[model samples]
Target: MQTQKIDFAAVQQAFLAAGFDLVGVTDCSPLTGARLARWLARGYAADMEWIGRSFRSRVDPRRLLPGCRSIVVAAAAYEPGRPPTDSSPGKYAVIASYALGPDYHRILRRRCREAVTQLQRTSGQPQKFRIAVDSGPVLEQEIAVRVGLGVIGRNSLLLTPSFGSYVLLAEVLMDTWVKTPEQKPPSRHICLDCRKCVQACPTHALTEEGLVDSRRCISYLTIEHRGPIPEPLRPLLGTHVFGCDICQEVCPANRVRSAPRAPFLPGSPAESRYPSFQELLRMSPEEFKEKFRGTPVARTGYQRFMRNVCVAAGNSGDRSLKPLLESLLSRRGDDPLIREHAEWALEILG
Candidate 1:
């Protein structure tokens, strides 16, 4: 006996049941690889060499999974709570909303897997599918746009009409075709004349020309860059210890949305939500893992996180951090990344 055909309504229901905030589908089509090639050629991707190497796979989902016919795109809303404030005795560190909880890579993967399973079981024959999260070279935002999720804001993030720019994206590539949903106008194609995200970037990473120089992006420096942040951009980092949200924070489309009541995101422990610079500076490698194991903070590990904490301390302008910064500076350590940032913090404080 042949199995029943997969129902689009059932697949959509499965995604929603799996905690996805929005879901859309599109047939596989060629993406704008030439534009991406131009971006990479300009070195806008910074030190992320994988982007250049994986350009073909990123632009064409076919490179990721052979015989892929359709893509199911999902978006999970992450709450962008109040911005981090430095009104405390010392500096209060800022982490992006996406990194506050358990890493969404795992969450999205597991959920997408279950979603695919839910989908396959209903199909006429066994189905083949592959999961793609942020780490995947697939052009998720572009897929999201094609699938009618949202537009890409000036910050280079997907801005959903309901969730703003605070949504995490995931995709499932299937060997079989699914009915395509009606797509909204591409975000970049329909972007208004307003340049709020461009203007709000502290380091001018987001340019008036709608280009992002990732080397100067605070989020990239804090999380991805392993070396010492350049001295010139240190002050521009502000108190953001993990990731920067300035561009999204200033977006007008993000303001008028009816925010998700309970964001489809898990919450972090209270301590991790608002960590102290002194405590972070004192944390050992093991302790750092213990505190941030499943979250995105672990991606930076102890050395880089502490390195960022030192920068935040210096930028805090709070003389109280002097003793702690001194301790890091005076310690017998050859890790110049940490020591140099500590020295810069001291210089800033003095």
Candidate 2:
């Protein structure tokens, strides 16, 4: 007689039991395989080429964690108790909603680990198990989409019906061959005829098809890319000093959704929602690091981050900022990219 199979429901139940608002599982094969190939073929990932490089491990969860037979996808809502109000003018340092609270990677990974532990308690330990929260070689959104957690938005964000795009994607790869639930497909989005995102992008980064050209993406220039930001793009960057949500901001889908206070996220800002640019320009690297230690702004580093601050200052034309911009204008940064941007900011302010 064959040994009895462990219940897949027990594993699914474990994640929900452990506080994951969303959880679903999928067989470790083809659907994931094909999507990975498609994303790589388009070459839309830009400098994040690593995404394409880790193809096999991303598709075959078992390659990364041997004996893995089932993959679990989980999401946690973080809709912000109250999102940033409409106006925080003068080059505000707007952070992406996902980064405001404690790092979601840590939060989600711990939750996934807990769920795995609970699964182990009930489903029995096996050869191996692992969890990835945008931390490793998994195609998170693609997996989420294939696993039936959410629909892939034209913007490339995973949009869940109940939560919209405010949820973070996280996953678990386990050794046992647990059964998976068929994922419900995402609903048709309202972005059908509206080209709001493409039309609204200051730099035209959002291609007509919704694929963002990273070189033109303000968020990529200010946050992801190293060295100075491109000059022509400076003025168009607007006031966003860290991450930008312009596309989401203009998106009708994002406008009237009923998500939670985004409790999984930080509460409303005590004093202010968006960070003031002038304060950022003057902050020492050490000071900046401490302030945003794990926050999204910290990802940009000191010098590059300040370069953005300076640009925002120049654009504000507050007159009070002349002394500050003058200070940055004097010191030539080591990187031409940074210097090129500073020079452009001065031109804009002039």
TM-scores of the models, in the order given: 0.91, 0.87
Model 2 TM-score is: 0.87
Candidate 2's C-alpha runs over 4 A off are: 1-8, 32-43, 80-88, 258-262, 270-273, 328-340
Worst 10 residues of 1 by lDDT: 81-90
TM-score for predicted model 1 compared with the true structure? 0.91
- The residue-by-residue lDDT of candidate 1 on 64-138, one tens digit each, is 889888788888877665533444634577777778877889988988887777766666332677888888888
Per-residue C-alpha lDDT of model 2 across residues 68-139, encoded as one tens digit per residue: 677788887766434446554664655665666677777777888888787667657544778888779987
Q: lDDT of each model, Cα atoms only?
A: 0.77, 0.69
Give the poorly placed runs of model 1, Cα more than 4 Å off.
1-5, 83-90, 124-126, 182-184, 187-191, 259-271, 330-332
